[model samples]
Target chain A: MRAVGAEEVAPTSHPWEIQADGLVVRVGGRRGRNAVNELTLRLGRGVHGLLGPNGAGKTTLIRTLATVQKPSAGSLSLLGTPLGRATGLRPLRRRLGYLPQHFGYYKRFTVREFVEYLAWLKEMPPEAIPGAVQRALEKVGLADRADDRLKTLSGGMVRRAGIAQAIVNDPEVLLLDEPTVGLDPAQRLSFRELVAELGQQACVLISTHLVEDVAAACTDVVLVSEGSLVFQGTPAELAAAGTTDHVGDSPIERGYTALLSAGPGRSGW
Target chain B: MTAHHPGEQLLRQYVRGDDVPADQLWAVEAHLESCAPCRGRLAPDPIAEQVWADLAPVLDRTPQMPPARSWLRHVSHWVSPVAGPWLAMILLVTAVAVALDQAGSVARGQISLVLLVAPVLPVLGVAASWGRAMDPAHELTAATPRAGLPLVFRRTVAVLAVVVPGLLVASQLTGASLTQWMLPCLAFTTCTLALGGLIGITRAAITLIAGWAAGIVLPTIALSRTSVALDVAATPVWAAVLAAGLIVIAVRFRTQSRSS
Candidate 1:
């Protein structure tokens, strides 16, 4: 028999919105001590809400999307650029905004200095720094606190500053991890409006287990479970996917619980 | 009359993730599959041309032949931090060595302490270069990609480029000829910096301290013998060999960290 040699295969295509046919991630912790599997993401616009229990790879997926963590297998692209192929990520970073779950801010820096520094890192020209910093502060409703040092800001205000740095670049794609984590009700409402404003311009993906924020901010919902997408639909669809008896007015809390219990691919929420 | 694009509604539905009837989703997908402009937006821009353009200027700007003496001048400028203190210490030590050597030379001390202290310059020169190389800020700075390859290499090369001339000039000022020791001194200084950078700033400090003790103390001990061959300038080839080994390890460690 004629030897059948290695077959050529075409590469999978990735869109700005995720087109991940299959994605797998295995990451070793700093000293290669621990490994965790993170979810695979495909690209698209609008706010995609991520919901899962703790240690379910919600943060992991967000980090992977931000290009801080590499997937063990499968492909991903953000704003149309393949992760590895792009050598200098500065330009991509300029277009990609992120509010990590936690970040260290220089306590001595005034709000303006911190935001201006991030803008400089994004290579925003000297002239645009002031305007960008002000616009970001205004968007986050922190305009009054612009002159205050980070050490002087309240907990909620500090969280808002984190958000202000994130969107200062006006990135094409934005990922906010637990944006409402430490916010009071009033601050959460204000943050929601800012997210809505940003959604008008870029892809805004918010990962949080808190269904209320998802209900308030997201137009689309992505339920991740056990490192895989369990449901990808709108809030209404997600609610409808819950038990038929409570379908119509099913609250996000009830729907989110239903989705997780039904397990991966069941989509019962 | 307002114009209504047929695809506009589907686009809105798509963004909202609405459960559009299957027919509409299929039609939009079919249209997108064949549309080149739409498809191109979904793919990453090719970067080969951009990489070429960015690198071209840097390569072009590099000098074909820098002034032969420029490297010496650069080294002199760099060794200032350690050289300043070392020169003061050496002046004090040199006076002592000269007095001791003169007295010893007159007596059974045919080998002067001046001759024993000759090895001091190269050892101190290398130590100075390595000390500057191991600056704690440089280690933390290296951890960030912002410093990039060129910046890291430039800083490392900058240290090396500065130390050599400093050695040459200091030797000239002292009215000493480095006919045989020239290459070894150069190798020692360059290698120490390379090693210091490789093992990290802290480790490099420890290595420099150990090297200093061995350089001065060991040479004095060896020259204490009546044998004229044991003078500082006449260090066994093994000392140079050990310095070379340390330099190689330093270079290897530096390159490994850079790559990592």
Candidate 2:
């Protein structure tokens, strides 16, 4: 926080890479609830951890940012371009990488082939795909398994494969929903390091229930409950918001429960 | 990464916007990138004038791209490995039909088995290509920018590319006229796509195939004559149906893009 002086001398004064104003997204179908309802938030370069309980609209919000779902009402934009413009979203999609909560993949494809295929989908240059896929696999510690079929991998390796494809394009905005769901403790550590490195240039959003991951790697924490913002600040700030009064295992956990209790919706847990 | 560094005079020429000969330019650029101290020793670039002069040509225009290997990857790009099995099934069914027609299986006056199977061959392929249960990457693919009509049409073309030729050969062998089968085949495929845009592709294909069996193929097979749907009088009607299906597809995509 004390580095404000240095930031002022930086080239661009605009820091909000992702901006949303009264954003509302409907998931499921026409009868579905507004999963992301009237939410307004801004994010910049650095890893932002999205923390919310199940059914809190974390996945829905992540889907909207990934451009998989359209906002039913309100305004949303990415990298300074408001979505739904006449220019089209194809250009923006090229600069974005996303990993869904379920992370569906073709079992018949090898690790390298799958990542390369996704690179083609993201529309990377053909000449650049081979090297990019190699580097992404190496980053996720899957270089040796690149030739192996996805069906032959362990659960953690499949998750790493998903991560590899998500990063193959070196996207400007990376959205990962429940990315660490199947990763083991060791792989999760490496995953956090990789995410921190990516956050140097891209606006990386990690939506998960793991407060420990947020505390260890995230530069900022965003707490939402029932599709509304409960808190938005640094991890340290989130910890300080709690006391002995709240019930949780860790400081961040206590802070999370505290904020949820104060919010409009009650987190059953 | 080398231990040696470029001379001060050469570095100065490189930094001051003066021409550094090609012989030395590559070595100097490579060295400055790896050696930060040599970079710090250089004069300032307030306007990045040196950068503009040195790197402009490379940055201004992209290098020429290699032409796509139109024979190989062009097919693989639009089709998945899963399509291999489904396409094989379509061809296998076509072979069976051709065999049955040659054997004089029912009677000389009977409808050729080739015409009975041609229309629905692609319907099976289309169904397999887009079926959610069949493709594990369905949701992931939908997230990409090319996921909608572009993907649908690509797979459609890929399926057609295989089955169309196989059907052509089979019909030719069975003494069936091209116009008798080709137009209805196309019309049925387009109708599947049109209804696919509304109810979903897999369901549309199942409904159309079942309808073809009930209303057309069954009666033709039992009566040992050509069905009214494939009769010569209905040729212009098939053309109209094909055109209408295409319009529906276009209109559906337009309204979808608008509402989103």
Candidate 3:
């Protein structure tokens, strides 16, 4: 007879860390048109880049997965628990990390303090918090500026600090929306390396318009257009889907434009 | 004295994150900068690797680490940034109202200025406590598990803790009985939160404040008599409103939690 084991049920080994089935999220309160229209996705422990054009509901989808907004219809489950139910949310929340597209920081807070405060909110263990905060800051290359106030930092540095806070808990499900907006090329390169490392253990989902960032760091790419899945495949497959007829600088971008044009509801007002 | 090399022993200590003498650390890092083979000889330690990836462990050990966050910092985390100034403003308003009453600026022979504004003061404070405009991080705060009611209640209580004390002082000084405005003050606060569930806390607070100004304050000032809303005999009515507001709040939270 086999005894129950925590290892067997640990989230890393879980088949899919995030599962969504025909999910719908309405924006602008009730009676609003769906921002994320019937988004269906399954993600496991790996880096999956979410690529979409502007106003394609990428932020709304990321917000829903972060458990910030409730699904107006259908279902969403993270690390195996259904998001709709009223049970065990606190526990689930403790294991999640999110960086909003426009995360605000107290001007007076040092970079370390900001991450530490978020780690506390994420309900990290008190004893583990200090070390976890350190590791996260180091991971994002912000350890040198840890003691500096947020107001003193540059825009790119602030974005890196935001990334540190998001990873402080070593979260099972990490959601980042438009995380590379202010990053310089050198900063973006290191950010890609950090993301590649994080994807090895956790389900790291980054929603962005930068196809190059995803192609460099992501193991899998999921494309959405107008709140619907246009393509879900590896970077190689995405590159293979495109032809010279498509307008782009690279194979991946050409593929993205190709599939997006071919997908239903393309450029329809 | 190996000027070009600090030797393998000192390099090992540095790589293992063991405390090497400061002089040797400087010397070895300097030597490794110019000596390629010496740098290649060091074994990797995971902790030391992270600290010395691009630079050396010296960068991690900054002499002046910022002081640890204090207990007061923790308190402020739950409270909104606007709570302090908003509460101060409430006190200043209360003080002004008290002065108005002392200066014989009563709305009527029976109506005190302190009693007139006390009920709406907390309502205004509630708005400051929860307004997205007031909090720059509202989007991030709303996304957290502790975001919805728990966080809202924390800010609400912080507002009340300040406003209630100020109102008590104002009532005592103005010779207005606490019973006249105390229930209405709390009732308006709860009602703001209740209606907040439908059309945001800030909007609800504004609507309630506007309604109070238009419906009660205007009529009371125009007629030079106490409105029925502020009379002591309407304690039961205020009590009912407070209870109804609390019930709606509870129901709203329940539905919100289940859906979210």
Candidate 4:
């Protein structure tokens, strides 16, 4: 600990908020390795939205945060511990939730069964399994149909169930990848509400192409284009960066497209 | 003071399963629930209600075994479909062959080879296809922390469990006395399973066929002192050696893929 008088010192002790320092991953193979260069980010509580075009590596970044895929070249820390180092992730996993863009469940499993399974994977104590299942189902509004098998559920319902499982453990950090992709309008609204509510207690990272979701639900935005983060700021700040002549139907869309197309040195693309 | 929001109450009722109207329910009861005040509340609550309705089904699903179980299950996925029927057939053939051998018609050596190698063919075929099946689509959700090992191991375990038992039954049915064939059967099965795991199933099959051909042809052509029957008895030892090598290769390949 540094002296109390020192401005650089943390007064007592501080936990590391999630941090990523210079991540690089190459997907595909020898024909031509597609390089994804990810910038560093340290996020605290509230909803942080990751927005970008197709193949922007938003999914890759989310997977890395979830510890599902390792970064080819970088160090990532969750709560002050490096990822995949035998010790850190196991415990951190108990406090982490992830919703992949494409999720699959055992077709034979019922909704309740899937969540219970996830709860088990999350390493929740035996006694808390049922309660956790109930609470998570209630939060996602799935308690009633919990007895129905997954194969019987509609696509939207499946997606909702996926979200419920992701949040079942009440993770401190929740990473969602295109979570509302298949939802009906009403379902999407409820999911957005759930994200907003969950954000109050945890650091939630929502990765999606929909600007409206980021605009309405997220506290901040991280925009990635061609595997690089082009911008990071609030909605207003993001809007300001795109307002050229100051008149457009939807500045967010215009700005995002502009950013995606801009070459090496240009700002925010 | 807040007026009871009928919609909120209804939404809660729906979640609780109380609002699901039965065939015998009174229209009055249903109507009491459909008033404008209730309807207005239900409109805003629909989104939440729908979300819960959708997710409720997922909560009913079952939990799978942990990492160990998962590995076993995945292995079963590969093994069961391809190996199960073949094992059953092998057992049936072995029973018939054993009956014949007991009746004193078929040779012991021929019955033994058929019983041992027949069931393994299907497993070898499926195992070889694994290399082809290692497509990007078969890849599990990359969002998991396990680095695909759990997924790969699960499939492997399930396959081995199915294949091993089948081999044992076939050996018994071939009239190979349990006391005589048990250890060798185990050794053979272990070797083949490990080899199948390492090289593509196709290569394992080719190796098996080539070994059998060489065993029969080389001794005959060279007029060797050792009979093919004796070489057959020593087959288990060869499998054990091959299995050890495959294990090493599989481990190295797995580590290399992950690091790359």
Among all candidates shown, the one with the greatest lDDT: 2
Q: What is the per-residue lDDT of model 1 for residues B1-260, given as tens digits with 9 covering 90 to 100?
A: 12322365676675567998888777666766677665444443469668878988996576432222334334433343234455555556656665665455534664444434444444454444333253322221221223332333343344434444554444454444554335444444444455554564335545655765476546555665533333345555636755775667566545645443
Candidate 2: which docking quality band?
acceptable
- Cα lDDT for residue A30, candidate 1: 45
How does model 3 score on DockQ? 0.22
Give the per-residue lDDT digits (tens) of candidate 3, residues B45-140: 688778667665655575333445676456666667647788888999999988877887665446677888988998888888776788776666
Kindly list the per-residue Cα lDDT of model 2 for residues A76-118, writing each as its tens digit: 8887768755245766777788888886787777787888788
Candidates in order have lDDT scores of 0.60, 0.83, 0.82, 0.63
lDDT of 4 by residue, A1-269 (tens): 11222522434232545787777766664464434585777787889989987888888788777876657777778766676554545556677888877775667667877777666656666556677788888888888888888889999888888898889877778999999888888888888899999998788999998888888888888888777778878876777666565434577766665565663348633
Q: Distance (Å) between predicted and true CA of A136, model 2? A: 1.1
- TM-score result, candidate 4: 0.64
Worst 10 residues of 1 chain A by lDDT: A1-10
TM-score winner between 1 and 4, please give it. 4
Order the candidate numbers by TM-score, best to worst: 3, 2, 4, 1
Give the fraction of reference interface contacts each candidate recovers: 0.00, 0.33, 0.36, 0.07
Off by over 4 Å in 2: A1-15, A85-87, A265-269, B1-75, B100-109, B210-215, B218-225, B247-260
Q: Deviation in angstroms for B98 in model 1?
A: 21
TM-score per model over all chains? 0.54, 0.79, 0.81, 0.64
Model 1: per-residue lDDT, tens digit, A112-142?
Answer: 7667656654556555566677888889888
DockQ class, candidate 3: incorrect
| Model 4 residue B48 lDDT score | 84
Model 4 ranges off by over 4 Å = A1-16, A84-88, A244-248, A261-264, B1-162, B177-260
Return whichever of 1 and 4 wins on DockQ.
4
